[model samples]
Target chain A: MPSADEIFAGLMQGAREEAAELWEEAKEFSINTCWSLASQLVLVGQAFVAGEFTKAEVTKYLETIRLQFIATLAAALMKVEGLAERIVNAALTAVRDAINGALGFKLIV
Target chain B: MLRAIVVLLVVLVVSGCSSFQLGERYDKSLDDDLSAFQIEAVTFVASMRLNSGTPAGAFTSDAAKAFYPKASGTLSNIVVKAGLLSSRQCPINGIANSIGLPTIKIGGETIAADTPKTVVTGNCAVVTLLALQNVLADLEASHRDHQKIGPIRGQLAIDDINKAVATTLSGLRAKDL
Candidate 1:
């Protein structure tokens, strides 16, 4: 039978891999959102330079876009943070379960 | 090995089971309402794009001006509905200890330290809806000022609204897990 230390090390390794994957997902989401928002802004800048929008209209539109991006970014970050918390809790639970199973009793509670 | 297990349990007990959180129970009604709104919003923007150069679809035209009040009213209803859901549903609690409460800031204003998680988890839907409202208003203003929304700007607005709604819906769905 595998010893408790060895079982724990293995479970923790799995947990670390899981956490890293989640982190990578979060990073990618933020990057993509930034890219999308920047692209829209570039379009606005181009239109402004082309004399399509007056200065006041451009300024107002930019402010509105800023607010829109802020809310979207905030919600995205919240989703990431919430998922990370859940992953941590799950990892701990897995370790506890593995330890208990190895000892043939409720060893960790 | 036994000693290590004991130490791990101690750490777990100290940390608490699910005290660290920023999520609430999944509300299906919230999901339905937002999804419905998304269709309505995108469809409206698409219509505006199609009719950009027509006098009948002009922002200042009587027909176009009539849609604003109805759209704004629907959004206001959504904001209220989401607020009720967030306030009513509580996140599951495994252990009653909070380790790190992250301070959150949006648009340069810091949310209150004590309620950051709850606000983010609960009020995030409301916040996003409110932001969408602003976007709608901006669209209205742009249409009025410019006399019509060009196809490019119309598509951009649709894309923006779609993304915002998708992110919030996904977040709300995640809370179920």
Candidate 2:
């Protein structure tokens, strides 16, 4: 027999929980991106160390590095597939408001 | 005949100098590139961090100003020195240079030093990326109880930066984008 306010609160809590869950996923994707880029860089280094790279080879490797970072960050936001942009967006909104409060910005709609 | 030969030799010698032909990448530029990459990587991580206010896709909007080629300079230097980021490389004489490796170029810049002309490599942006990663790891390790951005929970300001870059590249793709 929860009161009206209690029911409203319950609904709000559920929404927040859902938002948090979505944010968690986007965050994980970002982390995995960082790690993967780092790992790929190491592999490129190994190839270079082994005297296995030509001038063209090195250029290609660097291109890959640039692309990975661009792709990872872009994918996180663009919602092209395999990622939950909505969750990330929701979590980020919370951060923006907090940052605005702490940092003291005149945020508009 | 002797004069012609001397002229030919000089041409040969001059053309072989990689430093003369390549872009003058200073420690500053290398630093700039790696810092940009690190910032991109971390901010993306930040979205998953302790952000309670940031909206989805807002990471870019929030970070657009702070995200750019100029902003990530110092962080990149640290990463390259640390060997944490190793993928970004430079192409030399048709070969891929190893990333995250340290290199001191006394001869690569267009503003030449008093040294012999050579395609000096190492200590590049890729190397800087690695070093920055180490700094990040250490920072993460030391601040075991901080409220800073977690591994994947922080709002990484990447979208804004990437969009700007992508737009620029799309314009320049045919011209080596």
Question: Residue by residue across B1-177, what tens digits does model 1's lDDT show?
Answer: 977855765477445553335544457887888888889878877887788789866887775777788778877887787676555322311111132332222234333333222222335566555457767877887788888777767766787778777766776776665
Residue A7 deviation, candidate 1, in Å? 49
Candidate 2 residue lDDT tens string, B1-177: 967744543443334421111111223343345446645655544553444234432333444324332345555444345233223233331222222322211123121123222222332233213323333332233223232333222211233234334322221221110
Question: Which predicted model would earn the best lDDT?
Answer: 1
Worst 10 residues of 1 chain B by lDDT: B90-99
CA RMSD of each candidate after superposition: 13.9, 27.7
**DockQ for each numbered candidate:** 0.13, 0.01
Candidate 2 C-alpha error for residue A72, in Å: 1.7
Cα deviation of A36 in candidate 1 (Å)?
A: 0.5
Clashes of 1: 0
